[model samples]
Every structure is written in C-alpha cells, then in structure tokens.
Target: MTKAAGPSRRSERSRVAILRAALELCREQGFGGVTIEKIAARAGVGKPTIYRWWSSKHAVILDAFMEHIATELSFPETGDHLEDLRGWLHSVARVLAESSMGPLIAGVVGAAQYDPALAAEFHQRVYLPTRQTTIARIRRIQDEGRLPDLSPDTLADLITGPIWFRLLVAGDPPGPDYVDTVLAAVASQRFPASAGGEALQ
Candidate 1:
C-alpha cells in the first residue's frame, strides 16, 4: 500500500493552496469579493483549516500579496548604491503599474480606513518592515559617502513618495522612465557635504 502524506506535509500543501486561492480570487473578483468561504472552497480545504492559520480574509490576502511580492520587491546589492536604488524603484513602479497587486493594495488601503485591526496589522506587518529596510539601505549608502547628507527618512520618502502618489492619488501609472526621472530630480538637487566632504552638485 502506498503511504499517505505526513500531517506536516499535508498542512504545508494546504497552506500554499489557500494562499494561491486567495491571490486568484483577488485577481478575479477584487478584495471586496473574496471571503473565507470562497477561499476555502477554491483551495479545497475546510473553513476550519484556513481559520486555523489566518484570522480573516484580510490576513489571508495580505499573506498572499506579501509572498507574491517578496522576491521581486527586494533591494538588489550590485555594489553601486545608486544603481541598486534605481533597480529597486523600477521594480516597485512595474509592480504597482502592471500587476494585480496594485488593485489589491488599493483595496486594502481603502478597507484599512474602517478596520483599525487591519490598519494596525498592516502597519506592523507590512509598512514598518519595508520602511525599515529602505531606511537602513539608504543609511548604508550615505555612510559610504555616495549619497548626500540628508535624513535617510527624507531620502526614502523622496524616492517613494511620487510613485505612491501616482498610484494612490493621481491615478497615473508610473511608466518605464519614471525611475530615471525621479533619480535625476534627486541627483540634481544641491545638498550638504557628504561623509567624504564633497557636496552634491
């Protein structure tokens, strides 16, 4: 007789299935239409199975979204901080402009307005970690004397603010050249001396 899968293996498979189902449902029906019942049905798992792992549909969807973007959205270390920043920002623009993730993110942001729990979870789980990573990377670059002497937080905002504005408020897609444009604008600004005692021109 063939041996059955172990409990841990089966549980992991179910978890992957649920996350996949959540993403598919979000793509097909948007976040508003995705429910625990629908996700469980799509994943071929019982409601209790899903509830055992995630608290709500929001938690499931957020996990799916984060898993999907985790690889592509990371900062690349190419030994050139400016180039790395460019690549990272370009990835962000592409993901926001071209993927289902954009709508999902917008939907989550909208829902978070009314759901304090979700907003707090999002801040704690998603926003804070990413922001901390970006700030740390920028601080490292500054320490290398490659970037201007400015608050890393301010620099991070200058880099990401416009892209988010276009996606969330302006309803405009950040196009292929957007990253370069933003970088040029940033590089053009005159700033105080760097750690190497050279001013940004």
Candidate 2:
C-alpha cells in the first residue's frame, strides 16, 4: 500500500508542478510559444508524463488557467439578492481590471476562434459553470418582480456584455461607475431610482 501511495503522491505533485509551469510560461510567452516539450522541461518531467494526464499542451494550459481563476473568483451572498448581484458584478469587473488573468483570458478568446476543441473545452470547463450560477441568481430576482421578465440568458448578457465590451472592444478599464450604469439600465424598466439609489433595501 505504501509503495502504491508513493507513486500516486509523486504523480499528483508532478501534475501541480506542470500546471504552475504552464501558467508562467503562457503568461511570459503567450500560447503560441507554449509547447509540451517546454512545459515538461520546465516541470522537470518527461513529455510522456504530461501526455499521461492531458491530451495536449492546450489542455494543460486550459486547466491551469481555469484553476487560477476559480481560486480568485467568487459570488458573495449578503442575503439581499439584488445587492449581492450588484456586488458580484463589481467583483467580476474588479478581477478583470486588476488581475493578470485578463490578458490570459483574451488570449484564450482569440485562440478559440481558430481552435474548436479548445473553445468547447473552455466553455465546458470554465464559462458554463459561472454563467449557470449567475443565471440562477437572476431568475430568482425575476421571480421577485424586481426585474423585467427576461430569460436568464438575456439577463446575463445584459449584465455581462458591457463588461466584456470594455475589456475586449474598447480596451477601457472598468471604471467605478460602469457597474452602477449597467445596473441602472437594467433596473430602470421596473425599479427606477432604487437601483442607483437607496430605496431597494
């Protein structure tokens, strides 16, 4: 049993080392420059070791990138759901504006245009979980009659589209007022001044 445990632990350690090395390499050199050979060399493992766990270097990079983001991201609940949603939006904007993950995410977005497998894997592994969670939250608000009767998908797009636009299209930093403006635009159809003011509480 101890002999079996020894190899299992070593494999786990090597997996972590490879992911850490991959993230650093991708950040330093970008995805085009990252390769399995380089990651294995940096991780102190052979190419076969990496291939044993992941099908390709891109898979390894995706896992590493997703892992880092998951650790840093969260949706805090303050029991007031609307306030919580606003806070969640603020937190997301802050992450993109303040973290190194932003460029990495942009790289993946660009890469996905040319790589279908990477796009699918990224959507399944990274995007869908966050999207689904946010949608469920929005559905709850809709049920409360505080929001217009939009589908959760549309609601999510309304909330996230501007944030993505600022990052990807305009290259503008997410200013402090951006979240408020977005919230107000969505809230105006029903709640009016309460969204940007104090009446909601």
Candidate 3:
C-alpha cells in the first residue's frame, strides 16, 4: 500500500503541473496552437504522462482554463439576488477583458464547431451558471411583483440578450454603458409601471 501511494502522489503532482503548463501555453499560443509536446516540456513531465491523462491537447487546455476561471470567480451568493446577477455579469466582462482570456474563450468557441462534446461542456460549465443566476434574479423580481410574471429564463434572456448580441455578433467589448442600457430597457419594459419608482401592479 505504501508503494502504491508513491505513484499516486506522483500522479497528482504531474496532473497539476500539466494543467498549469497548459494554461500558460494556451494563453500565449492559443488553444489551437498548443501541443502536447510543448505542454510536456513546459511541465517537465513525460509526453506520455500528458497523453495518459487527456485524450487530446484541447481537453487538457479546457480543464486547465476552466479551473483558472473557477478559481477566480466563485459563485458569489449575495442574498440580494439582483445585485448578485448584475455584479456577476460585470465581473465576467471584466475578467474576459484581460489579454489572454478573450482569446481563450474565442478558442473554445472556434473549436466547438468540430467538437460536439466540448460544445455541450462549454454550455454546461460556462453558460449555465452565469445565465441561470440571472434567471434567479428575474424570478426574485417577479416574486416582488416587479416584472410581468414571465419565467425567469425568458425574462433573463429579454434583459440580457441585447448585451450578448452586441458583444458576440458585433465583436465589441461589453462596455459599462451597454450593461446599464440593457438593464434599464429590461426593467422598464417588463414592469407594469407602478411600484414605488417603477415596478409592478
């Protein structure tokens, strides 16, 4: 059992090293350009070790990149759900504004065309949390009678879609002005026109 533990510990160390190396390489070279040989050399591990763990270089980089983001943005649980949703979007926009991050997401999207499983994973891991939280915010708004009682998912889309459409299709940065504009439009349009300043029936 002691002997078996030695290789097991080595495996954990090797795994971390590979993940770190893959992130650096993908940041510099883009995920499409990253290679297992490069990752292995950078991590100071054998190429077989990388191959042993990940089926493809993309898989290695995907795990590495996702881990990097997860560490940065924990799912913040402010009791004020609206504030949480807005803050989450703002923070997401800011994080991706970093030099390598934009490219990393782009690489994932570009690769998604050829990789069906990866596309699904991207939606699961990337889209759902961010999006679902906004849905929850919309739900709270409805509960307070601030919205038209639509489903949270649909309300979130109504509120957030324009922002995403402009950024994703127009290839523009998500400006602060645009975030506020999206929120304003959603708030006014969805509400029935009287709840203190402006809310529901």
Candidate 4:
C-alpha cells in the first residue's frame, strides 16, 4: 500500500507546485503573459506534464485561481448571519484591493469576453459554483429570518455586483466603507409582508 501511495503523493505534490507556479507567474507577468512553457519551467516540470493535467493555459490558471479562492474566501457560518455576511464581504473587498489575485481575476474576466471557450469554461467551472454557493448562503440567512424574503439569486447579485463593478469597470478597489454601504442597502431593502403576499414596495 505504501508503494502504491508513493506515485500518488508525488503526483499531488507536482500538481500543487504547478498551481502555485501558475499563480506566481500571473502575479508577476499578468495572465496574458502566462503560457504552458513558462508554467512548466517555473514548476520544474515538463510541458507534457502540464498538458497531461490541463488542456490549456486558461484551464491551468482557472484551476489555480479557483484553488486560491477556495482557500481564502469561504463564507463564515456564525450564528449572527448578518455579521458573517459582513465579514465575508469585507474579506472580499480586502482581497480585491490588496492581493495579486485581483488583477489575475480581472485578466481572466477580460480575456473571457473575447474567447468563447474560455468564457464557457469559466462560467461552468467558476461562476456557477460561486453563484450557487452565494445563493445557498443567502437562502440560509433568509430561513433564519435575518434577511428579507428576497429572491436569493437576486440577493446574490445585489451583494456581489457592485464589488465586481468597482473592480472591473470603475477601476477602483472596493473598501470596507463600500462593503458597509452594501450591507446597509441590503438591510434597508426589507420587503414587508402584505395581503397580496411579500411584494417589493
């Protein structure tokens, strides 16, 4: 069993090294400058080794980016859901404002605009999973009666859309104040129950 596990452990180590190298190169050279050759060289692996795991540069970088996000941006599940949401949003703002991951994400989003294959892969591998997770969290908060009975999907968009806009379009980093403002807006937009059922007033 130990003999069988040796190659698996080595494979896992190689995969981690490759992902880390890809992210580091992205920080140093920007996403457009990253290539399979560069990643292989930085990772101390062969081109065939990278190609064995990922089909393209975009795929490799996307996986790396996803891993980084998974490590850094988990929604906290404290009993005070509102505070948890606030903390998570603040964490996102900090990352967008202060980390190399910000520009890397912006580069991927910009590239996806013109590359259909990359866009599709991004939507499938990144956007959908993230969106689903956000919606689920919103739904849970609503169930706990801390949030309004708004559509979780719409709530998810409302919570995250401004941050993306600031990062991608406004050319500005979202700050803690911006996060607080968003939370205030969310808290203020309460849909009160009526005879006609809960409707936006």
Give all candidates' CA lDDT scores: 0.83, 0.79, 0.72, 0.83
Question: What does candidate 3's lDDT look like per residue over 17-79, in tens digits?
Answer: 999999888778876778899999999999888888788776787788778887565546778
User: How do the residues 44-154 of candidate 2 rate in per-residue lDDT, one tens digit apiece?
Assistant: 999999999999887999989877766556777777777778888877787778656677777777888888988888888778888888887887787887677656676
Each prediction's TM-score against the native?
0.88, 0.85, 0.76, 0.84
lDDT of 1: 0.83
Candidate 3 lands at a TM-score of 0.76
What is the Å distance of residue 20 in model 1 from its true position? 0.9
- After superposing candidate 3, which stretches have Cα over 4 Å from the reference? 1-9, 191-201
Worst 10 residues of 2 by lDDT: 192-201
Name the 10 consecutive residues with the lowest summed lDDT in model 4: 192-201
Candidate 4 ranges with C-alpha deviation above 4 Å: 1-6, 190-201
| Span of 10 residues, lowest total lDDT, candidate 1 | 192-201
Candidate 4 lDDT tens digits, 1-201: 445558878889899999999999989998788889999999999999899999998899999988888756787877777778788888888888866877888888999998888899999998887787777777778888877677776677778899999999997879989989987888678764531232221
Comparing 2 and 3 by lDDT, which wins? Answer: 2
Q: What is the clash tally of candidate 4?
A: 0
